[model samples]
Target chain A: MKSILRLSVNGKPREDAVADNTLLIDYLRDALGLTGTKQGCDGGECGACTVLVDSRPRLACSTLAHSVAGSEIETIEGLSHAGNLSRLQRAFHEHLGTQCGFCTPGMIMAAEALLRSNPHPQRAQIKAALAGNLCRCTGYVKIIESVAAASATTELSA
Target chain B: MAALSDFRLLRPASAAEAVRLRGEYPASRFIAGGTDLLPNMRRGLVTADAVIDLGRIAELSELRVVDDRLHIGAGVTLATLAADPVARARLPALAQAAAAVAGPTHRAAATLGGNLCLDTRCMYYNQSEPWRDAIDNCMKIAGDTCRVATKSPRCWAAFSGDVAPALLVLGAEVQILGPQGMRNLPLSEFYRDDGMAWLSLAPGELLLSVRVPLADGWLSAYEKLQIRGAIDFPLTGVAVALRRTGDLIGELRIACTGVSSRPELIGGLDALAGKTLDDAALSGIDRQIRRGTQPMETTVISVAYRRRATPVLAKRLAKRLWAASA
Candidate 1:
């Protein structure tokens, strides 16, 4: 039950033969070698496998590859351009947002979605947007700071 | 990670086509958002020889208002439903309930039909396959005994969906399509008390849309007690809709979830229709809810806690809604 899936990933169009039951996470990690989307909880409980499906944050582990055949998917690997870290990525790195870095990719991806729609979100808005994602290291103070710092920087478009 | 078993995926373009496919593949399961069904499939709680993806059916994604009733297609995502200005303004309780589902990401993909038809859950039944195997499985899955109440003949899994109680209070009606044809039924009649067969859908049946009547001048609210502020199912969820007339109770409806196998409407409230929502009426409503709820050991939380908390939450919602109407 494999089908040829035509989708746009990281702004590049991809057409690959994926199994009918292949999860989006596996399709990104195993098929395309996009390991930036981590699978912390195999199920949807943990937000570690989050990716943007058509500019909205979605759980990759719960989505089937074929279900999003024509969707525009953005992963953590798509953030950098011309070897320069995206503003959110730079903020996370400078503010020590990554202690173990397990949840950073998903966190940043979720944050990227939030910042796109709302450039100047409040602290409560950031917390609500990332509520689905879980981070065990740094107690989330640095993560919040990282997103806030990214929001304050007016040089680049989210 | 639990691997999902192999199954043929069928995508249908219309509701009629989806129903035809269901008739074609009797063992097929309809999947809308895959938020609830996919996880259950991974846990080995459900199996399907073929999965009918209803996400592509355009007819089932319509959300419109006609003749003072909001017609919400079954495939409408929770996020869309929550953000709809009409839904937010007309049925604030339902919008609040939809917004309060799992989280931002889950609500993005989770649909109204999936939430309405959510599987009943129990602490023992929702575990991993191997974990359930260690306990020899419960009646809801494989074995004959109901772990929550071993002596009982039926499963005691609690209906944990947050949207059902809100819809029940709104007096919603569901449009169902089956081999026989389309028929409408009150949302309250759509559920049964049995956890294993909670929904009243016949074979080859599909929920098409939900029609909610626009209740004018009625203030409503939904409240729930969850272990976490987000990403947790309600231990006890209560929804109240009330209209006030000259500082007296005009109309009142209360419904609750997470305490029984079905999201139930709290009865015996007609007596309080004209009575002002004073402290005495609130206490009376609280006692009625406490007496109506029959929680079992379906969740990690104790039955006593749910029993006590269900009434408190209902009373609080009633008080809040009543005050807001003033």
Candidate 2:
């Protein structure tokens, strides 16, 4: 069945009519043309498809489009404004967070969520928050550094 | 490819409404989180026209304590159930089991109801129908003689719900609401010994909630015997609950999960009442568990390894319970 989902993406009201079985990842990439969110291990293993649903990081591939019908969703493409990247997004580039770029969107979204609730998180807390995400190529040394750097940067700005 | 995009999805308000809708569309499957259902649907393990999402059902999403029991709605996520203060304080076994299911992301999405009613899994049968047919099918899907037990008449698939064993020790009751109205029965009575027909639930019937009697003066814990620390299903999971007084065990309930099609409770093994958890006592319990289990070749891990680990799990669980009680 065709279901029209009305959701607040980033900071705007976005509505899309999708099939009942339309996966949220595909809906974001195809319907909305937001391909920044990479799809890896659509079975919800690798956190490559992670996106913020109501400020909580969730796997977009495993989530159905119909399920998120009156909820707020945030994708990587919408994380930035006009022509500038978010602080967390830039921190990844500076901290060597993105090696293959497959897990960047998810890593950034997870870090963004952590910093939203906690601008200054301990190293152990940051690691726990990113436990679900997998970065096989980098061994997660840089990703952890990226989140820590973002937290420190957020702390400095505050 | 064109999707099956013409079916209407109904959002029921309560268990009663869910039952009513089940009556209306007897073919529609009730969806709570869809962690299990969606994957099974993609594999064509279950076929359904409409997905009646129960996520919006307000009455089915709560975790409450009533009188002497902890009631967990079917829609309660594993993550929430693991962190529920009342459940954590009263029934630590259940909380521990919930925490060990899948992973953080999976726990956030997998619901307690779905975990309890998890589909019976066999290495061969859990695959796609086409994949099964390619091998001339196994006993669970098509062909007659059991591949695992060979001469056995029935299939030997494993029932592997991480939270079930803990709840079994807690002596929980299941609240199942269906087209025939609602009925609450002891959780132990919910399953049959048969693998293919593990659950006694009727088709279209939805498990609404699970109620566990609070552990009083007793301590419990769940131990998973798997390779990985986070995302691993135990080849043989054990839940042990023992109450001790002075130098004797007051009450002991040791159960096994994934050892059989349905979680098996050792009958005469409960004779551990007032028995001391000495080395000899532990050995006797291990012997009994070894004699009772005898896991077949059906699950992912080797049957020999699982069988060997069963007794080890029993002994370890006994020792842990004894130490905690002491």
The local lDDT score (0 to 100) that residue A94 gets in candidate 1 is: 98
- Cα lDDT of model 2 by residue, A49-108, tens digit: 888888877788777777777788888877777677778888788988889788888888
Clashing pairs in 2: A1-B5, A1-B6
Candidate 1 chain A TM-score vs. reference chain A: 0.96
Fraction of native Cα contacts reproduced by each candidate = 0.71, 0.22
lDDT of 2 by residue, B1-326 (tens): 12223456777767788788887886688777666666566666666777788878888887888888888898899989998998788788889999888666667778999898888777777676578778777776658766677788887888888999899888999999877778998888898878789998997788989988885787888888876556556678988888887899887787888888888776666677777988777777787777766577766688889988887877787788788777
Residue B145 Cα positional deviation in candidate 1, in Å, after optimal superposition: 0.4
Highest DockQ against the true fold, candidate: 1
TM-score of 1: 0.98
Residue-level error in angstroms, candidate 2, position A10: 2.2
Evaluated on CA atoms against the true complex, candidate 1 attains a DockQ of 0.82
What's the residue-level lDDT of B252 in candidate 1?
87
Chain A TM-score, each candidate: 0.96, 0.92
Q: lDDT of all the models against the reference?
A: 0.91, 0.79
Q: Write the per-residue lDDT of candidate 1 for residues B80-152, one digit (tens) a residue.
A: 9989998899899999999999989999999999999999999999899889999999999989999989999
**Over 4 Å off in model 1, which ranges?**
A155-158
TM per prediction: 0.98, 0.92
